[model samples]
Target: MNTRCLVVCLAICAGPTFAQHIDIDPRKDVANLTGEQIYTQVCQGCHMPDAKGAVGAGRYPPLAGDVKLASGAYPAVMVMNGRGNMPAFGPMFTDAQIADVINYVRTHFGNAYTDSLEPDDVKVFRPPPPSNPPEKH
Candidate 1:
């Protein structure tokens, strides 16, 4: 096959595959998702399928057997506020979802912490919205 034809064929074949794997949907409501569902659909993208995390341009900390998860509040705050390179999910996720996911991670992925976070607990960690709107420049 000619080079142009080969490129066209490859693009056609790969298009559907690429589209199928594009799981991140910012507009989709995830409020109803369970902890495991949240982790699989969202967190696994960075943390890896095994929850061992990854390192390349930036480091994604391993959630497996993490000591920080021992304190439910710590992870709850981190998820709400974010730290370092991690993006804040506070605006996107509901308190319930955050609590559920944190609880899930705490129990699974080599972690055995029995203490689970409640949605009310997560509410305390969320930063209050700005009282005044910023003026447009």
Candidate 2:
């Protein structure tokens, strides 16, 4: 009940609380960041500035440089499915993040797919998951 004990107890209990800070730069784009700023911060590390994927498992694919994106499957599905070993960004990225990344990929890596994806498009089109096998009778 003493003031010194109370202060010491509060400090002990609040240890690590003071160190936690969740500050993050506000997102500037809805889709993945493509410019040097956002790219270097989030995409360039795994995807290389040229959009070339890495050589290991879980290595991200070469964004729009790959032909799979141009096909009718739609960019939204790709963002959601995350082929090879890339984790599904749907849960992690906002609609804008999805759009920005998709936009960056489509234009980078010497790729020619020039369509700018809208957040609404990404929001609506989720790729279908693989079907489950039938159960034995």
Candidate 3:
């Protein structure tokens, strides 16, 4: 990596997205965990163990083998859109964690799969968080 590119990449990845809405799993990608484990650890409470992740009347849509997240369009939509009750994990989880969770969901849930959700991939999805309050320093 050259200095200029290094600087650019550094500028892009200098800091992690700081947000109050996302929850990143310390463990890399939920895929490393069992289906039930992923549920109890990160999803169960909201989506439920049955994959019927419905929070209520259209709150959390079921993430069963129904949602077409594994499409060519990119799973970032499901994560970034904050669609319905689905919150974006771009900031909360480390890139690895995001990849893990996404891989888990893509294989276990996304019916018609196309790709694997990598951490490097998730990193790109995070379009800077709403400008942070001016630094105190």
| Candidate whose TM-score is highest | 1
Instruction: Rank all candidate structures by their lDDT, best first, as comma-separated numbers.
Output: 1, 2, 3
How do the predictions measure up, each by TM-score? 0.75, 0.55, 0.54
TM-score ranking, high to low: 1, 2, 3
lDDT by residue (tens digit), candidate 1, 20-129:
45432333435456889878766777787798988866788899999989999999988898887666778767899999999999999999999879999999998887
| Whole-model lDDT, model 1 | 0.76
Q: In model 3, which runs have C-alpha deviations exceeding 4 angstroms? A: 1-39, 55-58, 72-74, 109-114, 129-137
Can you list the residue pairs that collide in candidate 3? 24-93, 29-100, 29-101, 30-100, 30-101, 47-53
lDDT of 2 at 3: 31
State the lDDT at 18 in candidate 3: 20
Clashing pairs in 1: none
Candidate 1 vs candidate 3: the lDDT winner is: 1
The C-alpha stretches of model 1 lying farther than 4 A from their native spots are 1-28, 133-137
Instruction: List, residue by residue over 32-55, the lDDT tens digit for candidate 3.
Output: 554345445555556666656554
